[model samples]
Target: MPDHQQRIAYLLARYVNKTCSREELEELFAMIGQENGPDIPGDLLEEIWHTAHPAPDIDYEQAYLHIKPVVPIRRSLPFRKIAVAASVLLLAGAGYWWLSAEKKTAQITTVQSAPAPPILPAGNKAVLTLADGSTVTLDSAGNQVISQGKVAIRQSNGQLLYAGQPTDGSIHYNKLTTPRGGQFRLVLPDGTKVWLNSASMLRYPTVFSGKERIVELDGQGYFEVAPDAQHPFKVKVHDIEVQVLGTTFDIMAYRDEQSVNTTLLTGSIRVNKGSVQQLLQPGQQAVANNQDQQLAVRAADLRKVTAWKNGMFVFNDMALPAILREVARWYDVDIVYNTSPATELYGGGIGRDLQLADVLALLEGNGLNHFRIEGRKVIVLP
Candidate 1:
């Protein structure tokens, strides 16, 4: 095997073992869809499959059929040896298939362009505001424990946790804010865990008191509310209120969006807006339209709704403007359109951890829209 092919094999093995670094993962995916790239050896793929699944009767054709429904195949890219290798490995229960899917179909189209600086993905970073009007910049490097009265707060491995119980019967509120190109995970006093997406703000109590536990949210958040039957948990986002005793749900209430969406993953939630209210079950979504104040319920694709929380941007027949809005928020860049393309819809999921160049290339490759990155701004061209 040649040097490049050998490297691919090594990376594939490392990826199968869940030991590849982020940079290695990116390089592997970039090479997978190369039009004329070197072929991955069939024996190497068979070895990987046998090692991972030990099943002698497993049929590759049947396995591919199982994946065809869920795994998207890019019609633009030629079916290469890497695709076959991916199919075999995925059938053997390798987790690398998910990462590979993000890059397989996002090939950039040919375009004359200047080499613009790359914009990296957002990370676990945020600003925490205490009740005393003090702010702490939270990052992965900090290991300090901060105490305010009876409540203690600390960050470990990018997740902020609260220790100690509230005994003073006094309520103290703290706000966690993630700027553009940033995200954060927080554990509230009541053990409820929250994952805040980019450009989002969550105002929560340091310790629960009174009759109900309530929090105010602006922007997007995925919450796993701690079950407290007596003290119901309620989230207030704009004009909508989501009440649940215990459940996992996602709320998208960005000001730029036309409606507030609440996607329930487990348990049940009551979505209320003014006099309009609707109950949502698992796998269901409640949309509250801002214009008519009407609440609508529909079955939802949970994977697409919570893709951001899972480190992917899944767009399903999404509009161009909506897609650009998400790209701008996650990359912390401004978007300007010189001429809008005719109405276009996109369907695919890309890794949110990819650089702006890779993502823009995917968009351009689909022949949907063209973009030019200038400094911190992306300009759409005719």
Candidate 2:
């Protein structure tokens, strides 16, 4: 039988690396449920589970702070060699070298390791710029009305709401922007609930009174459009336009992506780009290329697409460059990498509430990778 401590260590390594099998994860979960299993802290256990299975109920901030990683003890030599050397030094010191030489050798062997600092968790907030060029920070309080032509813009509950009792068909535009380490939500006049991810921007009219409601987007956002049979909600990203009557969908239209992806969660939507048009159903996605004017429809995992709204950072076969883009936004930090393109296809989950260190630990669990922090920047080494 394997030693219990060795078994636990292996499981811990597998869990951190996101390489645990389902059965292994189940066993680890069972162990965590037990109060007498190892000396593992409750907070650290929660962080491990939350990273592997992120849900809306998980408190990312708590998990982020609770999971304290154990730094490896560093010596000038390997642990076995150090132990042998220490024994030899003890024998030699019995009666040979002078007291001062013996003292110096013992001092060199007195190993000291680095201690990690407490991790800090963060939340989301952003700014909204009205068509008139006035800015309103969403996280701040005090109801102030910003005039964007006839539209009355008000911020409440971190959401930018447009007063609906407008008197005309006049058009007014507003832009919602999420800065680094920030996010915001909005309820448009049409009753649509849109959640903007960090480092993203959205431009929409103050009122959607016309036959076609249109909006523009950059970065990422999740949209829950209210039913308006007469006036379809249309989202314009670069050149592609997503049209729907009433549906919940997530759109990834970041400028860096090779293809713009629109994933539908409920109801239906149509993607139209100049001469080409493609329709999508629930759990479906439309990948459109602005450069080539080509569109392809395929099945999509709805949870993975809308995970951001649920306060998670779930990735399925995502590239390292893409993953860092998201990590930089939520943590409000920059990344410096000194490694080959990550060839490993990552398939796992993590909550958005995790501290920067908590996330780096998970990434380092994977072999051939390590991370360090310098000021506000995260450096990835291999």
Candidate 3:
């Protein structure tokens, strides 16, 4: 084998074993985008399938098909080998993670020339507002601990973890805000885990005070309560409040969105809007209309509901405008409609790690609408 091919194989193996670093992932993907990226040996792929276990919710065959059109895949060889190999070794936990689908497909967009620089995907980035209103920038490149009183706030591995007990019993509120083109993970002092999406803010006390552990979220966030039966965990957003003893759920209360949705995953939660309260069971979602603030219940699409937290954009028959709204948030771009919003519904998903152009191209390939990029704005054409 050639030197480049050997290197590719090594990187591919490292990727499958889940040891590839961010720089290595960038290199591997650069090779994938190359004109003559080398193919992996079929035998090596077979070995990979036999040894490595695949990640959950991955349809390797579908993902392989998505990549085969653009990447080098020889039809002369058996399809099963390539598909199985991709299924087993192409774990997306690393940066080399590409598009995988559950019976979905992807077509790599062809670029003719550069109109502007690529808009990259969001990473672990946010702003931490201290109790005194002081601010600190936190990103994936940062790994440090910020001391505020007795609580030790550690930023590591793209997540903010709070350690130690608060010395003073007085409540101190700290806010973590992720601007456009950013996302963040946080562990509260009470051990509750929060994954904040792009263009979102989470405000909470440094310590769980009194009888309730309450936090305020301004956008979308996934929460896994610390299982405290003694102190009930509460989430307040706008006019709605979610009350729970201990539960796993997601709340999307973006003001721009038509409705505020609270999806329950593991435990039960009560969605309170004034005197009206709706209880949500596991696998159920409560939708509160923005205009009337009326709460409605429906079965939740678990995968699509939590796709962002899992590093994917799994849309399940979502309308074109709704999908574009999400894309805009992740890529930190403004969507200007040159024409009326299309009523088309789309399915399937792609990796959140892909670029904005790539994502737009994938969506355009569905023949929904033509998209043009102008600086930070994405203009839609009919």
Candidate 4:
């Protein structure tokens, strides 16, 4: 309940919410060392150390100052109480907004540390599972053709394509799955470009010969839908449906994700969930959750959302947990935290190709958090 602990909690919430400047971070660090520095739990110390350091190439002072401060909140509560209370309030607010006419707030925070897992190499490859249960693994080694009545499967250019001649009266579906630590790309018969992130699956028909081209998804995928004014491309993500005629967008519809985010890069599209239909323009993102009746639209930075496809890990004021999620996907590893970190922000750059240690080394540069990699698990210490 000391003022130092309260300030740390306040800053922790701010960092997780993607708002905290470098000068503020430096001030916080100095304050931590002065008063409650030793009071910080041992397990959380590693996370704190990681956040302070971020990466070896970073100018901590500059990176910290470049980021913005989040909306100010009352910071007088005890650290533990604030953590529990904030999470509870956030959950309740999201739930309450789902069934009422009240407007929902676009704020989020988490109590977690730096997310660097054991570096993992990309796995063999991914496979396309036909409706008849036949599988086709894609790579440069070999390419084969598989037919399930009418669809043709081709593996070329490191991608699996489902190109088929259309037939009236009947429809056939095919599935693409990427295993743990693996990822793949695919082009639907209708020219829809899909980049499936690791551990993702997409189910679509062989042909878009119907009134609407609909697909089901699990995990994350970025799509560039081919233009067809008359026939719209509808993506069924859980209960939400993203309808687009021709546009470039990204959809993070992973089941484990708290919300399905549909970020539009170009053109126009409509996101619908039952009675709720929200129109989106370029540079806009629509977030739909199971608890909400409608999709929430907001401005977004396309680069940050699609950084994985571009072969980088860009954290523009991201929380420790969210950052870890990206690391887990790319490295194909699990994360275990022994403690929560002192509220600090991580602002810098790291490539996806870097070794896991290199990434952690950067985080440790902050001198607040520490990390250890054990097999496929990353144990974070404060």
Candidate 5:
């Protein structure tokens, strides 16, 4: 008899190869359903990433997006590795990480896939509101430079960039907003790079000057702050402030989310909430709980935190409700739950470039829940 690990490995290989019998598929899912899932090694994951090739249908760039879940999720399964396998083999035409493809890829979802219009994924779309209150539709602007007062803002290749302008001390504010099902990138006057996620907003000055550089954030963004030790950079999110000299970090502060999370990738930062302050090192995260009005620090999940910027929807041990919120933002859909979901922390991810039906298929094959789509509304089923 094979050991548990050996059996899992065998079943997974067979599943990928589309050679699994119904019984074997049931057994495989049952094993994963146990209290604790398999423990795969990190090196093996790296090996899979380095050697695996995508199926013929998927292009190299598309497969690369799915294969790049670098950080481990906070779950029993090091599903980050499985995500690699899923991307190369399954998500090319089938499921997320685990599923019985409906066809050669092993059809898996319980969601009704009758002929219907598909909801496409988000792209480089944002509305830039200049200091003069004039708005430029960035997605259609292509590569163009628009002048706002004395500053010249450049929009190209889905990015908004501008060279550092000398401030006349007039201090005008410009806002960048990513609508639902849209995202955008920006290069601030000081060379700081900002990746705005879906339904997020960032407000900044026309140029860097005075004692410090500051920006206000309303939803989510990943920041690679330009190094300026003399002039610290600070991000204002509600009541919390993340202050740093030069560092790469991500912040999630959606109005619907329960907590405001700040994950630091490189360099050090100080997170201040009123009088309470916490210093964070690289690979650390500061979480501000809205309900209790408290702040705490812990090790960060870099992959999960910055997955949006990387072009994957990686979720680890997240509940259905929370995951749907992400889906709603990126796909611009409403979630209507006909059945309350089990409180299990499911983990998996797919390339964000895929459509809504593809994403739901990936999630449904996990054996936790399924979905039904009505127009722009996603009806969650048990």
Candidate 6:
């Protein structure tokens, strides 16, 4: 078997033995249904079954055949990967599927999908505001290069790239803004890459002429800075500034959010806010409180922090209001609450590419609250 398949087999064994870690379980779910991979062999499946059951009388072939007729696995499974993994666990007699058919039926009967509002996912859309006050609509702009003195700006393959160095010593700044329900990627002149989330703005100079390269951000952005020991890259988000020589990090500093977060993925970063400064290693996060002007550093779940860039919404004990705030930005919808919900925390991962109705449906299935979508507004009811 291939190395990846072998790894998967090993993971399956660990899973059946109830020894798989949360990260390993997530990896196993991600690998399911991956294309160009061989189907799990029967021998491995049998081993997994016996590891979980530990009974010699329970025949794997008979159990699989019995479930095959009832489950009906066609050429393609008409279910999400999480759902499939749940089914597999149930087949192994680990436990009942978390999303059982009875619960789904009850949810369907209570919530009607046809009348809900339909909001499409965000796309590669942003507006470039030049230094001269002229604007370029990136989504509608064709494959054409615009020149600002010696600097060349162009959009290709859904990414905005900057090439050619500035001739003169003068620096001209440009701004890229992504409205609600939009996102964009940009390549700075120093070969650094940035991913801008919805309702965010980035302001940067056309060239790096000074001792330090600095950029200002209004909302959230992920940075893959190019290595330059002499000229460190700095991102200023509101009151906090993140300094790095060459590192990958994400900064969340939305005006509406109470705190500014800087999560370091690779390399190291120095976060500064007022007189407070914190150095972050890999898998660490620095949070700056807007009101108290205090900086706190803690270990971070990198997957949850960077999930937005990977086309998913990952929550780790996230509050209801916080999740709704993200949903509002991504779907470009206003949220109205009839009654304030109790302090509720949720943890899960869902595809950000799904439609707003689909995402809301998943939330509604929990039966904790009701949602009514009217046009571009999502009304929350207790």
Tell me the tens digit of each residue's lDDT in model 6 across 50-131: 7667655434333322221011122344334323443344454442223233334543565455554447999889999988
Q: Which window of ten consecutive residues has the lowest lDDT sum in model 5? A: 100-109
lDDT of 1 by residue, 1-382 (tens): 7898788878777776767765775576556655566666667766765665665644444443222112223444453432463363355445434344443333222332455456899988899999999999987677778898888998987889998876867788899999999999999989999999999999998888878999999999999999999999999998889999999999999998999899999999999999988999899999998788899999997878888987888765567788889999999999999897637554455678777776776565434467777789888876
- Per-residue lDDT of 108 in model 3: 24
- Kindly list the per-residue Cα lDDT of model 4 for residues 1-56, writing each as its tens digit: 66766676666444433355545555544544332243544334334334543423
Decoy 5 TM-score against native: 0.82
Global Cα lDDT for candidate 4:
0.64
Candidate 3 local lDDT, 1-382, one digit each (tens): 7888677677777766667654675576455434345555556554553455553455555655333111222334344544443343344433123322211223223232345577899988999999999999999989999999998999997899987777767889999999989999999998999999999999999888789999999999999998988899999999999999888999998888999999999989999987789998999999999999588999998877898998888765577788888989999999999998667545456678887876776565434476777789998887
Q: Judged by lDDT, which candidate is best?
A: 1
Error of 1 at 368 (Å): 3.1
Hey, what RMSD does candidate 4 come out at? 13.8
TM-scores of the candidates in the order shown: 0.73, 0.69, 0.73, 0.68, 0.82, 0.73
TM-score of 3: 0.73
Q: State in Å the error of residue 194, model 4.
A: 0.8
Predicted structure with the largest TM-score when compared to the true one: 5
Off by over 4 Å in 2: 1-122, 140-150, 165-169
lDDT against true structure, model 5: 0.76
- Candidate 5 lDDT over 161-250, as tens digits, reads 876464565888899999999999999999999999999999999897899999999999999999999999999999999999999999
Better of 1 and 5 by lDDT: 1
Q: How does residue 296 of candidate 5 score in lDDT?
A: 91
List clashing residue pairs in candidate 3. none
Q: Which pairs of residues have clashing backbones in candidate 1?
A: none
